[model samples]
Target: MAPMSLQDLVASLPTGETWGPAASEEKTLNGVPYAPFSKGDKLGRMADWTAEGRDKERGGRQQYTRNYRDQIYGAGTQTGFEIQQTEENTFSLVDNTRTTKTRGFGRGGGTVFRGRGQRGAQTQRGGRGTFQRVGGRGGQQGYDSRGGRGGGRGGRRFGWKDYDKPQRNRDASVVAKPDWKLLEEIDFARLMKLNLETSEGEDIDNYGFLYYYDRTFDKQPGAPTSQRKLNIIERAAYNVTTSDDPVIQELAEKDEATIFATDNILSMLMCAPRSVYSWDLVINRQGNKIYIDKRDGSNLDMVTVNENAAEAPMETTESTKDAINSPQALMMEATRINYMFPNQTVVESETSKREMQNPHPFYNPAEESDPPASKSYKYRRFDLSLEKDDEPLHLIVRTELDAVVKNNINGDDQYLTIKALNEFDNKAQGSGGALDWRTKLASQRGAVVATEMKNNSCKLARWTVQSILANADLMKLGFVSRTNPKSPDSHVILGVLGYKPREFAAQMNLNLANGWGIVRTIADICLQKPEGKYVLVKDPNKPVLRLYEVPQSTFEEDGEDMSVARTGDDDDE
Candidate 1:
């Protein structure tokens, strides 16, 4: 057992065997090939650090335990493990080289990898694959289909908080019948582009008398001394429609004008582009004549408050808890104030009143108890003929004047058209951001007027157009406020302000040429049709005008009843 030489120890081993271990017959184990390695290499680890670095550079993770297996055995080497063939094994393949598809769940399930600077990266999971591109700055960013924000510069986005606003659904003033046939549909955009210049209309006849305007109301607003409680005066006032006026009918029979309308109806048509509420006009076409009329109890007779407001007063419903601030109540309150305000602000002395060429046409002293209000009716004629027309188109309108004021510069009488803007409650829901007129009218008059212009654009536009049509020398706007916010019966005149019609129109950016064009456009549509009655209606929810051909007997019943009533009154007189 002494220490032997290295060569003698190796020679003493059994044949086909080495000193370290038994020699194998082949370079394979259990039918699996062996991987070659150098003895100088370091011991293998459970995880390959080099493979981890390479996987990270590729921008993703590899299968779990794949790296460790490759390090220990070799790359692409599978252990010779197999299951015996059976019924379950015959259903699917045992090969791991191919990927197996998986079923997805929940709204196209897949992994969404969102990042920057890694382009052409794909993810496959749950039977779905998504190709993603992580782009850098200055590239087109992506957005979520569910309205999520994408990566980009930040600012206010479009349609932000659109869901928070309330929806407005208004009803039409008149319902359409099945027998009526639609003739034309026109939008406001097309009407705005039209233009027609008209001259100062000619005065055909004058009726009714106007008293002098009481200058006391022109005192400074919000002053304790200037405020006057509105008095309910008894006066005869008439709002005769065009076709119902006897004078207009006489003029029509004489062929004085081919087209006839009252100031109220004509002004509504002229300023139609500014309207928000639905309105309609009745057109009767006789032989070579056209008459623009309004139905009985039309909305044209009611004065609207905040009709053009962004958030107008809501209608009364079971869900609406507030009824005083509703649109119907507000309109009724405004109309009552307008009717009584002018009569209370005029001088009623017989010596001081200005008489027109004719007496009150619609007033009968024997039948009526109250005296007539200070109002004048002037029948004026305007030319709406185009250069290419074969015949001249003339429009005669029955315009009314409220009162007369003496000019300060020349001491001559100036005709005036009076209108009032009312306030119910500034703190109400649909006040349109109006200021308290009692405290702010004197100091911030301009601000109050600007707010009114924004809230009542359509209303004020109609009044101004009416004044211009009447050829009034001055347009007076009275500020009237409710004494109590809860009551509609009691009101007081805060003050009165005057503006020249043309100057006010310029301030409002009102184009007369555009208004004339609207009238002519509507008129031409009727002129081309056969002799019959037509109706022009304004859409409620949309800014459009629809012309329909109605039957000749559409409004004949109401007209006949009105005729019978008038005849009975005349017989009693």
Candidate 2:
């Protein structure tokens, strides 16, 4: 090929290769130091891509939306009043059937008088003194139903009428949890079930059980009455805390066999939404606790988790020969996880593999692992399944503040929207028969964002919805370590902490286990650096992505691995 003259170059140039003289430069979000756009970012550069109901949204053939946020699929515009009215009507029917029985038992001479002292023999009236007895008298037959509204000295049992509007105000309080009822029934019930498992356990397990209480429900203003405490997921057989620390904590750990590149990235993102805007985690000084809420301000309950939540295998661990997996999903194995506090780090191991003389029927982990060393129980789980098996592009993010967790008018709508994506999405199918079950289960919990095709040569481009709870700190309950061990991908978690699971796990010598582990409140966030390049990530606080600290990134760069040049922070050992 010969070089052409400047005049000849213009003549042979391809069409639509350049902007015309009339084209004026428009500011983009890609400029350095400061991003041109934020939460409500708007721009002509990517407007069409950002528009609703469009393909090329995060490389999908469908539109990107908080699809679950609408009435058709979302929480809908339904009110708690409607639920209450329904509940009341149902309760009324039940009340009618049992009103005479329940109210009478509380009021009349039967159990009431028996408690009052058997009409002068020996019992204290233990109920609120409000009864009306009008039967069994005149001494015609002394064997008649001999009892009066006896406990008329006990306190009045407060009913719905007793609660007033002023008493339900959250004006002076902080909503640490969401109304569990407002969430999808299955999701809420699952959380409650986990709470019960822990609470009902003996020994040190209760604290682990109690740790998930904050996630149990949203604690609405009045509808589904709740104790006005820091709204826990489940109450213990005793509302007991062995330590004065107030909140109880637990943890689960495992190392993914992160030998390859793809596995590494997927492992990181699955932990939580790695978006910069999502870094705002909740830190409550009073409870000495923290919670991760999506941008919409609701708890990130880790519903992707299953029974034995910390023992599930992840894609990376199972896909690799030397992989380690979390033991969350295998019910065959019994596992438990907990933490060594103050230091807030982790250590994991296996327990007895032999069965006892008599076994209490449950998913027994002990008897299954013949030699304990032969144990292998981890089922991989993915929160989102794709229509296409191709790789899903993810953008990590980081933020400066941790958002608060609570319930409010705006927060409720946001919760419904998120649930529509999370809980409902998993159950929704775009088109199908029972075979499309997986397709319909369409849950997505990230926020929608956009990107371009290239620097200058572009039409409408790609977009995505990122998650606010990436790299979360999780506390998985029901992890029984005595039998089943944890896998590398932990499904049960207290919730997410803002830190990469890989780097943080390494620092703690972490190995995913069926039992508990706590990552001493680590915090940070991830996000794309310099925009459209979509390759670089920056965490001002975390050094994992810092060029200076990780001189040679362990992550794959094209065909090369950055591991050789990788180093911890120079400031660190």
Candidate 3:
């Protein structure tokens, strides 16, 4: 009486009281009484009866009733439940003790009829109509002892077969969004030098940003099944002009210029192999044939001359033998090349961050009309060539083009710009699992940058993959993001975009090193650009040791065919 607790007061209340948990009692459904908030007893009995298997000795009508009841209501052994006809042709479950009636399926007790009713059929007829579960959850098509078939008036109910039926092909139509021909016509040499075009057809200028579409499975014809839309990554957008004529400075200050960077670059590198031969070509117009420039590796004097010579014929023979020896592996490699930039441009500057997010720092703002200073650097093309014959099979990347000038340029005036380095050597030397190429490549500053870029690209790629697979819809569908997200670095060396962990490891071990190896030869040439010494890069594909020299003149002569010549004449169009 002093202070009644809630529990005590509830126990003290009368049965008809408004509160106090409503005097817990047996709840009933369809006349079948069950303990309030508990269906365990009823469900257990039903399950036990069904587990005993169907009783075949019962009378024909009784057997039909039992099977039909079990199919419709699942082990129909509810103690106080009775199946009764609520109408002339309709049936219902009635819990007589509880004085309750249920129509369709329910948690406690209910009547569920499968299959539609036929016009001339009734329960009194010669077993013409009987309930048969359709194609639904926990529903299976089965024949009733009394009914003619599984579905009423028919031998069987039509399920998925209706939709699966074949039909005539649809009419021809045009593609909604035409595929852009901009990347197709470019030669590999020029592709390395050209900037991406904006939606309005204006050049993004000086490697501002490249648009990356998810082409993981886009090798086949037609639109890609996944991630077909372009994702623009902004780099140098000082020259980009939108229809609104928005101020470029305002856009930059507002941080509106960049959409994505490291990820985009990583994606491009991942998809570099797709455009290997055509990387250097860009056709600003439709119907223009993609022509190769003099710098084309396939068109090089060494390639042409060597092909005509013993080395060329030997290469063809070796290639055929190699294909025959390992067709699957070689085919995989061919597919991989599409996503890798065998020849990549990695620009370095004194003030730019190691990430190299933007190349604007290398641009001369004072000379608004002039091209960026980075463009003036000779030997713009940095190529990564494979050497399958190497002891462990490695890659050698070098500049395909040479820096030539009429004036004798001293070493101090001209320098070798190591654009980018791809770590293709990643084989484990011993039990420690350390990459032999890592230590080998990190030997020089130039190679260090390339190694860092490669490693960092893997990190970025992993993160992007994680974010994409973490989507709720994707996860619900049982899509595995990665089997090993934290193991051996990405398989960029194999030119394969990393997806599953084990797959990446297998490919990496087969084709690449775990980390990176700074080719001392290439890095040394890149670091010490002194005039007398020539930068030597051995072409792994060719026997020739390509020699590059920096001329005395640091700048190009006016009217000199610059690195990229725009002779389309249809620039305005």
**Tens-digit lDDT track of model 3 for 84-180:** 3467656554532221243322222233334322112112111111212233222443333223344543233333352353432211111111221
Stretches > 4 Å off in candidate 2: 1-267, 271-351, 354-536, 539-567
| lDDT string, candidate 2, 1-573, tens digits | 998998898878898787467554665455534435464332222224333432453234332233222323222222222222254544531111111223333332233222211111111111111112222212111111232222223322222123241221111001111211111111111111221001111111111100111233232211223212111122111111111112222111122111111111222322211211011122111121122112111112112222111111232233542332221121111111211110011111123122223222122355454211111111121212123525332111111011112333454211100111001111122100011112221221011100000110000000011121122222111111111122322222212112233333443222221000111112111111111111122231221121111221223253232221121111011
Q: Per-residue error at 380 for model 3, in Å?
A: 22
Specify the poorest-scoring 10-residue window by lDDT in model 1.
122-131
Evaluated at residue 147, the lDDT of candidate 3 is 33
| Clashing pairs counted in every model | 0, 95, 44
Error of 1 at 536 (Å): 0.7
Score every model by TM-score. Answer: 0.71, 0.16, 0.19
Best by TM-score: 1
